[model samples]
Target: RRGDDGTALDRLAGAITYAARLIAGATRRTGLREVYSPSSSTRGLRKLDSWVERALLEKDESLSTATAVAAEAIRQDLPPLFAEVVGRVLLRIGRLPRDMPDAGDVAYVPRAGHHMPLPPWLPPSRILGGFYVLRPIGTGGGGSVFVARRAEERHEETAETFALKVPAYNGAAAHTLSEEEFLRLFREEAGALLTLPAHKNLAGFVTFDAGAKPKPILVMELVQGPTLERLLDKRAMSMPLALSILDGLAAGLEAMHAAGIGHLDVKPSNVILRYPDDVGAPARGSTPSPTPVLVDFGLAGRKVRPGCGSPYYGAPEVWDTAAFGDRTDPRATDVYAFSCLAYEMLTGKTLFSGDALPVLIAAHLTHQDGPESLQWLRRHRQAQGLAEILSLGLRRDPRKRLTLSEVRISLAELGRKRLASLSWPLRN
Candidate 1:
């Protein structure tokens, strides 16, 4: 059995290497410049082989760490597009347990003439209505987002690219709903997003392909910059920067609510920050201030539903399955999630921590003062006002929570006051 497991792993590794070579070749042909010089490509392949070997040998260590190492090596030596494709392939293979038996690996190996499932990042021959997929930017909630450009595009240009979202269900999620049902849900989301007009703080919707061959796809303007989640992982921002981000998010949420829609998922992962010059068109040489935009309406709806959002950021009401039948206000749920985000930004810590849903729900229901570390925010005059605003927004009851418009107004007022007090260059 052990020898069989080894053989299976070897076959899987060989398949992965073939897939990587294909991806590398595709990127070299499609990208503006060669993703890797000949020397770097050889070195990258050697590093990937080493990482995979180490991952198979270290049964106690996490496979994800090995994948990360492989991804980083590729990213440093190759273009981002190439790195994205190879990284996704490694991630899919890494998900299997290091000690898993041979039978469990059959699905990853191709049969007589069949091929293994392509990594979600790899662009299909057809990417819905002439949009050429470039690379994947993000993934969540049974969907994957790919950076794409129009069919008539320049190799060296980044300005005309967009993000394309398509269904890529993971594990059991793929079997949970029929293809028809999945398409219906995708259309429903697309329709909800279309109701709102375009705003600077919101990700712009370009088009929706409901008549696509396999499933519906959502095309959106690709904002350039790291996600708030990625930014926070690197370092925490200053108070003023954090507030600015929150203000932008509040503005976007207000627009959604005004259109009678709500973004149920409001975590940092769903927020992308682009500089002023980065909006609309990418500026070549300029240092512009960062602006946040709310993205990913996968879990958004007119009404709140149980089991619909990230547990740590979900409102108390979202966790109570019994109350799902009631007319729960999605706006309130957005506010609650926003507050959780605000708490994390300010304190650099999550508001709640638990592996169980009930515990997470209880944390939201019982903790009223927000994060204890954030109590220091009340010491500063402008921050005090911001804290009070968040307090109202974080209220457990939907009726008691401040409306999205009200939150935006309050944040604007605080910004104005802070601007009045700041020194010359900082004031602007």
Candidate 2:
């Protein structure tokens, strides 16, 4: 350990720079001559053996130990760049002796790699980047969200709890890009969150630091509420509550689309009904005036990206992306998904369900009806005009889809009318 400040950040930057130099050197050589003269390049495969032993002797245990763990996990299967032999060191947890070492560790990415199901484990209270990690709230397609608070409580605004999303970059996604490039994409996508227009119905982004070692983190205002999916499982929402939620969701979508971004995954699970100080069962009349907060921006980005959305919610263009591909407007996918959401919200029913994804995709593409929840629509059309508006949003063609502004306007109009309670599990 060449002593400077012996600070964790300094040591980490040194380690990252060293490893990058090694990879850069190795990539410069090719053919049998390069293989025969391994040491001439980046000191060959033996570099890793010595590198691990040399990392973090005089550094912060929390960050250094975590980096060691992450490096070990990532190096389990290093990819060759354009046929250059990138060294691979496969690691497996043989067994941990009962010594119970000084280091506090959690979040094992399993043999299946980063995309695997969230392993059940209680993360010990620790500092991750600048946030004090409390506990994980949920894991999704792209990241794991944790309930955390700022490490420094000096600022009044930074004192509140925040949702911290740590990336779970898919292994398959990095097939074509170098490790550096993939990491850059993660940073770019996370930074895009800062560009989102502020709205009351959307979870506010506090900050994003992609430079956080091992993984980047995003912070957002944590709303106290159950996911809309979880809420609906208990009982169907009342007329005013459902309509109010619909209004909030549409408004959020309008903001995103107007900003030229899209909340591609606009489903029940992503919407949270923000309640009072005590999170409780949603009461009558819009859950005693709760605000619907649209959360989860993992897949939220430019309309052209986020290719598709949640199953049963994605539109025809999204479901068959290969056929539609670049022609599909990303924002249109949200409009379609919102329609599916609105349908289920009112009728306590879904238009399609299948055990397999292909079956589900087939249902989405071929689905046709005057109104998706047609019978329920027939019963409620006399009372309010939301059903037809939803039908327009669900149009198969992306160009034909309802604009977010249009949906917002419709919801605002419906908000003024006295709506009859939607008999969920509807019997027409």
Off by over 4 Å in 1: 1-126, 151-159, 168-182, 278-287, 355-362, 365-388, 412-428
- What RMSD does each model have against the real structure? 14.8, 16.6
Among these predictions, the greatest TM-score belongs to 2
Lowest-lDDT window of 10 residues in candidate 1? 1-10
How many backbone clashes are present in model 1? 0
C-alpha lDDT score of every prediction, in listed order: 0.65, 0.61
State the displacement of the C-alpha of residue 320, model 2, in Å, after optimal TM-score superposition. 3.3
**Per-residue lDDT over 25-65 for candidate 2, one digit per residue giving the tens place of the 0 to 100 score:** 66566332232111222222223222332232222123333
lDDT of predicted model 1? 0.65
Score every model by TM-score: 0.61, 0.63
Cα miss at 410, model 1 (Å)? 3.0
Q: Candidate 2: deviation at residue 380, Å?
A: 6.4
- Where is the poorest 10-residue window by lDDT in model 2? 87-96
Off by over 4 Å in 2: 1-126, 152-159, 171-182, 282-287, 304-308, 368-387, 412-427
Clashes of each: 0, 0
